[model samples]
Target: MRPKEFVYHRARDLDHALALLAEHGEEARPISGGQSLVPMMNLRLARPDHLVDVNDLGLDEIREEAGALHVGAMVRHERYLTDPLIRRHLPALLEAVHWIGHPTIRRNGTLGGSLCHADPTAELPAMAVLHGARIVLASTAGRREVAACDFFKGAYMTDVQPGEMLVSVIFPCPQGAHSGAFEELGERLGDFAMGSFGVVLEHEGGVIRRAATVCGGAKMTPIRLPEIEAALQGQTLAGLDAAALGDRVTGLIAPAGDFQVSAEYRRALIGELAGRALQRARDIALNAQP
Candidate 1:
């Protein structure tokens, strides 16, 4: 299916894109990568009166500053996966992204577009939450920052208001002795996972100081499990019990059932996945110890 009639405006820069949006108001959609929005448009799920293409806006770049990474809105999935900086500092992201759709999809999909699309089941959103990334949203009025915690509101919903575009995402590099991993259970390779989880751990002297667990495809939004993270802190990896860790995951999440899987089953899967993710993350952390 083809998208309905709409005015296509190729933006020469960020200002032009914002100008188009300010003029069109809520009827306008700023498109980058066109991986997510195009599909919705073609299916008539989205019917914007104006499509502001920001491909030429010069928003593509990856730079490291201070102690974190700044990823351009136009940076594609393949770039993030292949970039040396990303591979070295954000391996968990690459691990998770490899599970998204296919290579061609990743080649064209933009990081900002994925986050703004705000799919509850998407890998990038989970990554943002996992690393406590900050999202930069811009408009003619200027730019404002939103923490990943507040950026995602619900399924396919975000804090992105009309006339605002997600300009970039700021990911803080993992500090201290730490290790992380991303794991998911999918019916087939290149297919959306029934559920996915990203785990990170920081430890010193055999004691955990910090822990994070974020899960995708198991709720209305990519969710971070504070309950689980809290439980793991101050514990030794060798003494960690998988059963107890799994219980916290299942207890904290209330995933809704669908035609393919039941909420109860998803809860069970979350429990099991949490164990596997945490165990792997712990192993990686142990290996990093000098």
Candidate 2:
């Protein structure tokens, strides 16, 4: 089905976008890459009366700021996958971007758009949760920053209000002792992951100094396994019993039955993915440090 009408607004800048959003309110929907939104519109899932086109707003700018990396709202997936700054600062994000759809989809998908769309099975949001990323939102009322953990409220839902637009995403730069890894199980190379996990670790004195585990595709929002992090803290990678850790992680997530996999199967794989990702993160952390 085609949309009943298409009212397009091209914003000269982010402030202009905010003005449009405020003026149109719920009738407006921000358009970045249109990779996801267009498909939904064609299926009648979304029927916004106005499209706030941000492609020309220069929201595609990407740079490193102080001790954080700021990626603008329109930064494309292909750009992200090849960005050296992102590779050095947020390797997990780079890896995650490569897993989002295929080359054609990646060329059209935007980082901010993917996060804002809030698909539970998507890669970037899950990795962002593990990295403790922050999202910058704007409206005519001004701007505010929110933690990735609190930003995603439910499936395809976020804390963003009707008149607000996501400006960018900021990720804290990783230190020398820190490293991260992402892994997922999918039926096809570019399909939504059946279960995916992101792990970030900080090592000191041959022990785990800090860790974060973000799991996706098994729940409404990315599941950050703080319990797994707490359980593994201060433990040396060499001394870890992988099997035991897997069993423990299995009990931590509450995955439900979906067409992709049974609840029980997803629950079992969560343990398996968590253990593997943690091990890889530890290895990467150790190799990078010394």
Candidate 3:
């Protein structure tokens, strides 16, 4: 199936894109990379009356401002694999990007597109939640920011209102040295994950100072594991029981099943992946110690 007939508008700038969206309202969709939207449109799952192209709007830079990294929404997935800032500051996100679709998809898929698509099993959204990232939205009225944890309302849903566009994402830089890891289980190398986990740990003198954990494919949106994080605080690396911590995740989430796997299977993946991710992150942090 093909998308319904639609008016195509090439936005010359940010204001032009906002105007097009404002005029068309919910009937318009702002497209950057179009990796996700195009497929949905082809399937007739999305039938926007207007296609506002934002490719030239220039939202594709990664910069640091006021202690946070400002990643333009149009930045392609492949960039994360090689970007020095991403590798140096967001290692977990870099690892997660490796699990995204194949080379062709990574070359064209935009960060903003993935977040807006809001697939519960995607890596970027889980990384965003784990890092406490901020999502920036712009429109004719003005610009506003939303927390990543709150930006995602559900699978394939977000807080982006009609006439608004996602401009960039603000990721707070890890302070005082930290190590992170991302783990997932998928049917195939490039397939959507059955379950995934991401963790960032800040430790000192063999003790955990801070921890952030987020799980994917276990909820409508990326679910942050505050319970596990709370348990990790002040825990010594040598004494930590990774398997026990993994078991705790099973009780915290209730994932829905699909044809590929049972709900119970997903729960098991979450528990197993959580432990592996947490232990790997801890090991990285400890190894970095002087």
Q: Name the candidate that leads on TM-score.
A: 3
Q: Please, what is the whole-model Cα lDDT of each candidate in the order they appear?
A: 0.87, 0.84, 0.92
- Which lDDT tens digits does candidate 2 get at residues 1-290? 87658799998888889999999999999998999888889888889999999888877878998888898888888997678898887877776776889999999898878988898889988977878889999999999999999999998899889999988999888765677788888899999788888877777777877877788866899988777789778888667565677688788778887887999999898788877877777777767665
The RMSD of every model to the true structure, in order and in angstroms, is 1.3, 1.4, 0.9
Predicted candidate 1 versus true structure: per-residue lDDT over 1-290, tens digit per residue: 99999999999988889899988989999888788899999999999999998889878888999989999999998887778888777778978888877889988889889998887788899999999999999989999999998999998899999989899999998877777889888778876677888988888887899988898777888888898889899999778785678777888888988776889998899888888888888888777767
Candidate 3: residue pairs that collide: none
Clashes of 1: 0
Residue pairs in clash, model 1: none
Better of 1 and 2 by lDDT: 1
The stretch of ten residues in a row with the least summed lDDT in candidate 3 is 278-287
lDDT of 3 by residue, 121-149 (tens): 99999999999999999999999999999
Report how far residue 67 has shifted in candidate 3, in Å.
1.9
On a 0 to 100 scale, what is the lDDT of residue 91 in model 2? 75
Q: Can you list the residue pairs that collide in candidate 2?
A: none
**TM-scores, one per candidate:** 0.96, 0.95, 0.98
